[model samples]
Target chain A: MSAGDDVAVVGVGIHVFGRHDGVTGLEMGAIAARRALADAGITWQDVDFAAGGSDAAGNADTSVSILGLTGVPFINVKNGCATGGSALTTAHAMLVSGAADLALVVGFDKHPRGAFNPLPEDWGIGSWYGETGLMLTTQFFALKIRRYMEEHGITESTLAKVAAKAFANGARNENAWRRTPLSEQEILSSRMVNHPLTQYMFCSPGEGAVALVLARSRRIRELARVPVYLRSVAFRTRRFGSFEVFSPSIPIESAPSATTEAAAAAFEEAGIGPGDVDVAQIQDTESGAEVMHLAETGLCEHGEQESLIQSGGTELHGRLPINTDGGCLACGEPIGASGLRQVHEVVLQMRGDAGERQVAKHCRVGFTQVYGAPGVSACTVLTV
Target chain B: MTKTRQFRLIDPELIGGTEQVPRLIGSVCAGCGTVTFPRQRSCPRCTSEDVQPRELAIRGELWSWTIQCFAPKAPPYLPGGVEEFEPYGVGYVELPGEVRVEARLTESDPERLRIGMSMELTLIPVPGASDTLTFAFRPVEEDE
Candidate 1:
């Protein structure tokens, strides 16, 4: 269970991401799965297990059926926005437990048309009900951004700057949903969704699927074509009754227990420290999450996030390149697929396959974090 | 003959239930001494099965608030679907006993909302709706 343990990610693949061009979720999953198997230079017969991640919405069974996976244990996982990371964690557990030598984790989503609905009233009343209206994720984060601005003397322009940087990064990504670079002025001028958050600051909903092939390190060395060893994987949910008290909205006397716990476990397993991360791909559900993560993950101290942003230390050429693939901000959230996509980006960076968006030097260890709604977060540290 | 159906907004109690009232439910671990909301079945702190349910404090200080201006996708529960409406403010309220809950603020006026302002939870009946309740945060009054 220590760092440099057994499992390695030998293959990663993704289907094209965008507004659905008539591709069903199952078809997308199958394509990504096939590509991953091919990338690992293995056949379907070599796979021992298959797992899928998606939110509760839509007909998940239809998509699972479309995968056409036969004669192997099939597991379905749903963890809100963290479905992708959750699925991977499940697959890794299967491999570590000796249930499967080779496990395939796939995530895909075709968001239901129209507005994202709140979890049904039956799921317990959401935190967002008032005479004024229901609070959605974007609006909730926008409020937090406003508070951060008020306290830190930051401005809407600072948020716009983050958007601009993400858009610029996205422009270099061929698979990115939004490929056009945007200026701070243009971002500021975009239509506002919530005060201080314009349309450009948010990610458009997109459809896509991603597949990751995980194997025991022994199998990896023996049969893998291109292997990215998984040095450490850790998942943690927020402590009870504390989600609302965390940073961005409220300054906690203590750091976020979930992120801290996950990071510590990951580092312990990876046999490394925060200083050792060559590249980072922390979750950016909102721009504010990125700032909070910078501090929570021990990448920077509290109150130093603005300095990191202002110095461009988080940009592609910075000492620690963070979110080099434009992140969820520009890549568009494919819901269940986002976690694996983060892994995919890191694999590409580590493999030196990222074209214009590549970091200046080789990246040996890449760290990724993914957070789910209802206060669940997962972090994974990958090393070659 | 079957009668045609009419649309109406219902209170949270009717929409959810009285069991979901009090607006908050969390777990307190007997072993490690921790509390969490939405009520986990097992104690996350000690991994002990011994845990008890507890209701959260209704009053707290506003951590922050924001007004949503866009239409959310699906389950058009909120008003003003495609058409934009006067925005509403949502904020995290830091309750006594170290619990923070995300809730809608009753006061939509941004000027009235300040960080650290005192607020309390209220179960308001949705207008034109019956037997249903929604939670909102109201600026605390001098008297209970």
Candidate 2:
């Protein structure tokens, strides 16, 4: 995509992420969508199209149904945890293609009651096993952590520091699910969910919704609103069956193709490089994944994440503040909405409206990433 | 009077196809050298409808593994309750034909697992349950 057809994010909104005892997924999406429309100084009638994402099949329909209530045509997208990023990408494409002048993208999910298992009945490789039982998401990431540690000489204590930092940041986010700060001692003392990974090291699965309003750059300028342009949005899946052969212990670095491909495409579109990113929000289902993403996102070199964390480079006052809105570790993962939440934070930081949790100085550009299971990844670079 | 336990609802496809043997289904693209496990009508690599069904090799090596000690937050699946097992190990098994499948490992002990260990696929009954079976990996000794 070229800058000529670039779309700009004019407004963003999100419901506080946490357990909501009474609200359904539809209500959450509607609430965020309304807030986004208001923030953009427009009404629901102004939306030319709508896009949504949800992990729960039921929730996807609910989101689409809610958007229809606004009298706008909508499409539902599902890409596992990357659903939100995928939704935004779809909205951007529609605007750039002239399918719509104004579009809304929303994502939301309600935590499931029990273990999260990939439905094997769905036509996919996961369904082949007649009844081998459900596999927990933690197990897949735990294996990656174990492998990373063995290969990179990383220790559990190092990973705990990331959790601790996220918890501290979470305490500053009024919308975060886990508002309490965790000390290194607390994070270290937490019960183990997977060896080397404790309870606090993982993001909580909660109910949440995020919405964004996007328009063609020309329209944004005409509307007299600060334009947060979508410089580049790229989605790439790993070569099937390559995950196992490629350093499972340090897969993030080994699968440089996915990250680099997305980054190159995005940067090329943005007319910038890694050095130009003032802030970033990377996908980290677990603390270990955050460390790995630091390297994969090019914020630091491989095997240098631990030192980067030790140097406090990712802190709010650090050179390049990351996940300043607490991240999944603190804000909780709403699956479908998590990716959008990352972008929302970046937009807020860029606009200097992040409240108490705001990063020092102004941020002009930021990057967000999200990964889907069975090996799919998406990255988007945004600039104000 | 007869007493019966409530059975969980499961997809019939998972109850084993008519063949009575669990088969890992995937799609191989004729236009490009790409294989998609669990079958796709259109090839992901080449985006061509010229795809055919291919069965994945059941046996593979253990690429990596981990034990789950926490409860998951989704549906149709239950974590080990207070009365059941608290934790279990799962691993990504790399099949001979280059498919990476996730499954429960028969080896519950973490210390016993090695990254490159040889493993074979097997269909076994769910622990403490009957009539329902799931796929898992069984360590293969050199002699076997």
Candidate 3:
């Protein structure tokens, strides 16, 4: 009889995104964990189960030495961008099964500068794919968006508008990386890293860390004020015919993206539809992703983004505010931490703790999604 | 008579057929009729191992496209430094009943590319290694 309401996120913590010269990813992760423990009004010694990981950063369990050797059964996750969501999924299952009363989940990563350079053999493709310069993730996004624009009447203007809104929202959130807002015109005119997508539209690989503390039902009623309930968490990989990152080719037939499937499953498990979500934080790996994911997640209809984005419907004060903390576009996507960052932002918005960039409308339910490499996605539905 | 030499392909397993009219080599699933570029041993759709090698259509329509306006890093990438790199076009060409093969386009200008345009496969030397040949597609000339 366990449901999403059975476990609650009592506390959340984040290390400022973007680069930090001397701080290592593990250090940032430990800092975020300590902050979350403090926010939950408890100590690390109180945690019984723990899970965390990073992409390029060191192993997550090594933090036990830094946070006191409490002998907490800690697990490490390394599922690319979905690392955060996977960790949360594990912690949630443990709490729901009565295996643990209190659990902590942390995600963090530190990637070097420039677009991520994934190896061909790593993705099961020949070296020719990368040797010929077709392995860039940016190229895939540009190609997808370019075709989407042609098919759905999405103009380049709408693409720039998405990035403009992201930076504008980032300007208000002090923790965001690209805090300076740029106009749509400026964004469109920025150096073209890929045709139809400018340099400003993409999120660079950066450094950051985020952590959350979960308390089962009984403890939430006793110790927490305004606990955001973890309604449902869903994770999925690409099915055949679905286009994903690092592919030499794709089938002529089309299928729903991993995000689409995961979002649907999440909403169904939570017993909440897309219409009930007042605010959301979707994977804005690029501006086009925000546009495509908006419809893919069922928040809107296909081809509806053309008008919704142009009219400022996705802004902080708009009808349905998206990426309230600027998302991956402005947050710089730390891979492991990006997914948790979305949940962290949603948790803040739901609790009315989001300072200046809070959504204007009263919000009860929040949705977050993270989609990444080789066709993987993780979605969550949270309610206050 | 001029001495003709054969071109060395970047990956012989990918591009096959005569050097003058190269065609992409893909695999077709005998069970479910699924096709994949660069070939695979099993069907991604039905999980059948009865896949056969097949020569794909040399001509198709541009499904989607982009331009690589920056230099990719080395190691996996074989291109030259940023200064020597030239922006190139990349896209997926849909082969009607077959699969969409992602390849480089000879054209670099975005204005010159359009969706659904006729594209024919061609071979060009790998950017850094002049002696190595790789596959690409170029817009089919109307006159031809």
CA-lDDT, candidates in order: 0.71, 0.73, 0.91
Off by over 4 Å in 1: A1-5, A56-70, A113-115, A126-132, A146-155, A244-257, B1-60, B72-84, B95-101, B109-112, B118-144
Better of 1 and 2 by TM-score: 1
Q: Candidate 1 vs candidate 3: which has greater DockQ?
A: 3
Instruction: Please list the residue runs of candidate 2 whose C-alpha ends up more than 4 Å from where it truly belongs after superposition.
Output: A1-4, A57-71, A126-130, A244-260, B1-62, B70-83, B93-103, B111-125, B130-144
TM-score of chain B of each: 0.69, 0.73, 0.93
lDDT value for candidate 3?
A: 0.91
Please state the Cα-based DockQ of model 3 relative to the true two-chain complex. Answer: 0.85
Candidate 3 Cα errors over 4 Å, as ranges: A1-5, B1-6, B79-83
Ranking by DockQ: 3, 1, 2
Put down candidate 1 lDDT per residue, B50-136, tens digits, no spaces: 888766666788877776665554344445333444456677788766456666677877677788889976655443243444566
The numbered model that scores best in lDDT is: 3
Per TM-score, the best of the predicted structures is: 3
Model 1 DockQ (Cα-based): 0.26
Tens-digit lDDT string for candidate 3 (B34-78): 989989998999999999999999999999999999899886787
Better of 2 and 3 by lDDT: 3
Candidate 1 residue-wise lDDT, A198-273, digit = tens: 7787776667888988998578887646677777778887763344322222223333657767778888877888
Minimum summed lDDT over a 10-residue window in model 3 chain A is located at A1-10
Model 2, range A1-384, lDDT digits (tens) per residue?
Answer: 655687888888889998888888778888888888888888778888888888862445455455556556788898878898888888888898988989989999897643355554452433323233343567667877777777776777788888887888889888888888888889989887877688888887778989999988577876545778788788876653234211221211133545556666677766788788889998878898888777766767778877778788888988888888889998888889998998888888888888888898578888988775755667888888
**lDDT preference between candidates 1 and 2, better one:** 2
